[model samples]
Target: MLESLLWGAVAAAPLVLGAVLAGIRAWPDRLLGIVLGFGAGALIASIAFELWQDGLEQGGPVPLAIGVALGAAVYFTADRLVERWAKRAGGGAAAGVPLALGALLDGIPEQLVLGFGLADGAGVSVALVVAIFVSNLPESIGSSSDLLDGGVKRPAVLGIWSAVAALCALSTVAGWALADVASASIRTGLNGFAAGALLVMMVDSMIPEAQKRAKDLAGVATVFGFALAAGLSALGG
Candidate 1:
């Protein structure tokens, strides 16, 4: 459990770093878009290679299908509700809340996967960890800045991200606890669930945001990010 917590924190620490960066300096939208593009690509690759593939192998097709469907439905529904609430709040001041919710949606599943991976006693999923770290840094930077732009007090912005980081870190422990007693099918379902959630998140939030901000260059960054993560996975395997 302690190990899981340690690794989880290590993976999520970038959010704090991103918040500090946003607090300290101004980042151009183009740059944030490019970073998000890369992160989206990397996360997509993680879904394919890290989460889904392993899940399919461990639990076979049925659970994978079920988990994926449920994960997508839940995330999509919850995201819409959050967006509606944000809109109801009125003005750009509420924009950051949605972004923060999005991050939580994305982060929790990824972190859960991290704990699950560690639970096997097979060591950390270095590829997944690297991808998570890479993806998170840009996300945090963008979200933190959005919060600032939304007129959230700076300290409050930091506090929000800090709390998120702590929650994600603890989610790993939850995964670890489950791993200790779960059947193979359950483990596989969890992986598939994480994959589905991540895919929906990328399509619904990350990719659109990247395109809105980076324009054409976002494509290039995405390709590079995918290639980089894929290479890392191949090498690790």
Candidate 2:
């Protein structure tokens, strides 16, 4: 469990790093969009190669499907409610909350999946870690920058991202502990759930946000991210 928590923090470290970079200076919207695009691509690759594929290998279609449906429903409903709450609690830059919150929601399951992967004594999945770290960097950077632009205090932005990162690390520990005693089908379902959540997040937040800024360049950046992650996975194998 300790190992899982440590590794989870290692993977989520990029969020804090990204937030720090945002604190250092304001980022141009176009550049931020490009970064978001790349992250989206990397995240998609993770869902395909790391999460979904592995879930199928572990428990087959039925469990995977059920997990995916549940995940999507949970994320969609929760995200909408959070958005409403943030709107009601409007402050200087509360707009940033939705984005950061989305990242948090996305990260928890992902880190949990990481913990699950480690539970089997198979060692860590280098590909998944790389994908997550790469993907999370842009998310924090973009969201933190947005908060700053919206007149949010720097410390608050950093604090939010840091807290979310910590939560994700704890989630990894939870996954590891649960997986230790879970049936094979349950493990597969969990992976599927993570994958489903990831897919929804990309569509709901990352991709649209990216395209909102860089437009044409966003597509290219996405391809670059995907190719890079895929290449890394191949090499790791």
Candidate 3:
């Protein structure tokens, strides 16, 4: 448990870095997109090649199907609700609350997957945590900045981010605990579902953000991120 929590902290490091970066200078929207895209691509690839594959090898088709469906449903539903709330809030001070809430919720599954991976094995968990930490940094910073730009106080912004971070950590703990007692088939299903959900998130959030930054840069970053993740996966394996 201690090791898993430590790994979770490591996984969240990128998010903390990104939040700090957001305070540095005005990042071009397109550049942001590119960076996020690369990160997302890496995440998707890692999920597919590492986690999902292992799950399938462990349990077979039923687990994969159940996991995929559950993950997709959870991601899509949560996203839709958040989008609606954000849209209703519009571009005002009040918008910050919903935006922060949405971003926090969006991070839950990622944390859950991180914990699940760790519970499975140290090598796999470490690789996934590192990759995810790298990916999450920009997002945390960007989201915090967005809230600040929308007129949220700095203290409030930090508080909300901290809370969200705590929630993410909690999710990982929960996932680790649940996975410990779960059947092999259930574990496989959960991992598969997580991969599916992560893929959707990458498409919906990370890729769009990266593309909005700089198309060429985003493309390069995406490739580089995937390569880096692949290397990490190999090392871990």
Candidate 4:
């Protein structure tokens, strides 16, 4: 538990740090786009080589499929609802609620997988940790900045980001606790759930933003991120 907590903090620390950093400095959208593109690529490799492979091996197809479907549905519905609320409120997600949901949607599962991976006593995966950290920083920075621009006070923005970070960190402990009592099938299904959620997040949020901001550089950055993370995944394995 302690180990999972420590690792969880290490992975999630970026949210708080990024929020603080964004508050202090203004980032260009193009740079944020490139970073997000890089992160998307890293997460893509993670879903493919790590999450999906583990799910197929541990639980077979049925639970994995159901988990994936449920995960997609959950994230899609929640994201849409948030978007609707933003529309009603005045502007896009950035102006209304900020993009913290974007971070949380993926953050929870990554932390869960982190704890689950540790359950086998083989230690955590550096690949997953790096992917999470890289992805999280830009999202938090964008979210925090947008919130500030929307007239949300600085302290409130930090508090909101802090809350998200805390919840995401605690999910690691929850993952460890759940994994301890879960069957192989259950673990696999949960892994599939994480992968599905991540896929939606990339498609709906990360990639589009990257394209909008980074333009030609987006594809290149994504490819670079993929190659680096894939190599790390091999080494971690």
Best by TM-score: 2
Output the worst ten-in-a-row residue range by lDDT, candidate 4. 91-100
TM agreement with the true structure for every prediction: 0.90, 0.90, 0.79, 0.89
Over 62-171, each residue of candidate 3 has an lDDT whose tens digit, in order, gives 88888878877777787777677667877455433433443454456556666776788845446655666655665566566666777777677666667777777777
- Greater TM-score among 2 and 3 belongs to 2
Clashes of 4: 0
Candidate 2 lDDT over 1-237, as tens digits, reads 789988989988988999899999878889999999998888777777767887888889899899888778877887788677667777545655655766776678777777777886768767656766777898888888878887889899889999999998898888888876877688777777777777787788779989998999999999999888877766555
Candidate 4 vs. true structure, TM-score: 0.89
Model 1 residue 100 CA deviation in Å: 3.6
RMSD of candidate 2 to the truth, in angstroms, is 2.0
List lDDT for all candidates, in order. Answer: 0.78, 0.80, 0.66, 0.77
What CA RMSD would you report for each candidate? 2.0, 2.0, 3.4, 2.2
As for model 1, its CA RMSD to the true structure in angstroms is 2.0
Writing each residue's lDDT as its tens digit, candidate 4 over 102-204 gives 5676678767767777776767666657766666776777677667777778798889889888888898888888877878777777777777777887788
lDDT, candidate 1, equals 0.78
List where candidate 2 sits over 4 angstroms from the true fold. 90-92, 125-127
What ordering of candidates by TM-score runs from best to worst?
A: 2, 1, 4, 3
Model 1: what TM-score? 0.90
lDDT of 3 at 192: 72
What lDDT does candidate 4 reach at residue 48? 85
The Cα RMSD in angstroms, rounded to one decimal, for candidate 4 relative to the true structure is 2.2
Cα lDDT tens digits for candidate 1, 1-237: 899999989988988888899899777999988988997887777778877887889889888888888777777888778677777876565554544565676567667766777887868657756767776777788778877887877898899889999998998898888776777687677777767776887777778888999999999999988888877777666
Instruction: Count clashes in each candidate, considering only residues at least 3 apart in sequence or on different chains.
Output: 0, 0, 18, 0
